[model samples]
Target: MHSSVIATQCTGAVISQRERQTDRDKEIVLQIRGHHIAKLDPLGISSADLDDKDPPELLYSHYAFEEADMDRIFKLPSTTFIGGKEKSLSLREILHRLENAYCRHIGVEFMFINSLEQCNWIRQKLESPGITELTNDEKRLILARLTRATGFEAFLARKWSSEKRFGLEGCEILIPAMKQVIDKSTELGVESIVMGMPHRGRLNVLANVCRKPLEQIFTQFAALESADDGSGDVKYHLGTYIERLNRVTNKNIRLAVVANPSHLEAVDPVVQGKTRAEQFYRGDGEGKKVMSIILHGDAAFAGQGIVYETFHLSDLPDYTTHGTIHIVANNQIGFTTDPRHSRSSPYCTAQPLFTTFTRTRLIHVYTPPSHALTVLSLACYHQSRQPHAISFSESLTLGHPVALIVLDEVCSHM
Candidate 1:
């Protein structure tokens, strides 16, 4: 029915649980909400940099107060009202759900968004704090993708022990999530996708998600031994494109990953420009036929100025690519250095990126891979349902096509 009805019912459900008082978990939930534990225990902390005093919350008494059921609360959002689950849940249950919703493999840092309006828009959109309903087949496919990601990296590590493959060891889910994006895009009638990213998981993305031939990857790795070709970059920096058949629609989908220099974020602008070109070449002036997805390292996405430039570029009349879905790889650590020394913010999702926009709808998604992918799927489906840009009637169209900027600065992304 109405979003207000949904909102009212959701809040009333929470109140009803408090009125009933079924178990200690409900009491723990009340205490947890009072403490605002979700803000206190974010998943962005670098485990490598963690000390004995900073063990993970699940491992220690991370909460301040001591209660009889302190250990009985669920830390994950499995029972939360999110994800389309219809069961009535206790406050503690929803708190656990909130924790996973905000502090899992992805964590949106929109709390720092400058304007109250922008914050409210994001809260209403992606931050509804619930999980999406996923089929068993989709779950199994996601698991298979995860397995493929880890298995491939392990193979490369064993084969080239000393080589810096920049393995997707921790963030294997990235490739799968991206694959989900492409699948979602094609489902939305998007024909071509131009992606750009730094070098951390480029090799994994190249080999696994891009579906580049294994033989080609092996050949490239062998070529990296000698500097004869003078390609100027290593194997991981190399870019490739592959076309896949969208069986249901009987359409051809082209996925292109643009090549980049050693600079962490330089590829962003290039990807946007390239996506715009694809739109023009295809003559889809409404900007619906093409899309862009830029992957970034958490450190670079926050530290670099070019990242900010791309956000501004999208608004310009000549430079706008209609939309782009930004995905920050956010491996947590920048090479060997920890984040505490690199950035001042508590989260890697920087505020300067989109918080300042006056009219644009900013969507921040930072949940774990399973939830992130599901949310992403719903976003694409909604985007597909959004009314197409009508004939030019106003100066500089108010609403651009959908641009989903995914933030996965969570520790579990590892």
Candidate 2:
């Protein structure tokens, strides 16, 4: 009689354990499904546009559901799972956190990430909770740069009403972001960065970030001749090479802003060639010390054939400058032409950098001057010192052109 009763008790305990596990498995499945359905664009759409309203088709069936048993709970997430670390919150709460972190104002398009290892590393960094924080000093530095950029432009508008400074009104944040990029790279032991950009916002970047003197800029407007040999095309197109000490990185960075022709994006390859020459002069056998940075307007980046030609050159074994950073100062409208007429791609960052070349990272972020450094650190933190690409949002104006800041770092093999 005693043996029979003991057997009955054991059977009941097994059934009870199975029922509890079944409920937990159902809950975890729902959360995982929610993660994949998260929104990822800054132009936040209404709830009605949500096509992912229904659960994924696979989760409806018997096999896929049963396969996700309680045994898998203690293990890492599988190929279909879309979560990071285990959390204590309810299923809805966890999904909300995941969406906010990965799919906020900064929309990162990493579908073209080439290596499986790199893709995983980048996803982990971007999805982590601590990715958003920055030190206090970093914030102050960004603010100072923003103030200088805006202050200089405001002064110019008042002082020289007739002169077309091509001011950085919408994209004042570019200055501070560049400041942070240089500082961050300097911290990582990069010695120099060669930058190229269009005439738009040229004056502001020159004066505020490049440390060009205001008096010289004013003098050029007063006495400059027609843009002839392109040596220093009219004052706005004039180029400068200088160095600044970065307190945050405790390193000095040498920067050269190359003069660009009015013909948009004509200087893309020119800057690369110059950067390679500089690397050779410095005896950077591996092209690791010097980085080439080029800024582009959104229209030029996508529509121009020259941009593709320039990208192809980087693929050649002889022509790689380790890596180059490409920033598209994307103000939505490229010149007077609307985006509908100019670009065939959906988002500005959705380009062929990874598909054609296979060695780039493309990230998009909405950056006002206030959030410049914080956004920059988050973009750079995951990449570890490797070359990749990133795009920053310009505060758009209806009548004025919108600039998209595209940053691409060319990768070098050791």
Best by lDDT: 2
* lDDT of each residue in 1-414, candidate 1, tens digit only: 110100111233323455233333433332222212222222434232223232233321433323443333322233223434344544344445444544333334444434556454444443355335478988888888888987887787677755655565445677678888777778777888888887767878877777777877776667544322346577777788888776545778888988888787899889988888888889987666788888877677778888777787776778887666777655454443456677765445554444445123323333211101111210111111111212222112112211221233243466
Q: How accurate is candidate 2 locally (lDDT)?
A: 0.55
Query: Local distance difference test, per candidate?
Result: 0.54, 0.55
The candidate maximizing TM-score is 2
* Candidate 2: tens digits of C-alpha lDDT, residues 328-379: 6665555545566665565444344433353555555556111010111111
User: Model 1, poorest ten-residue lDDT window?
Assistant: 370-379
What's the TM-score of every candidate structure? 0.63, 0.70
The residue pairs in collision within model 1 are: 29-92, 77-97, 82-130, 82-131, 83-130, 83-131, 83-132, 106-366, 107-366, 170-414
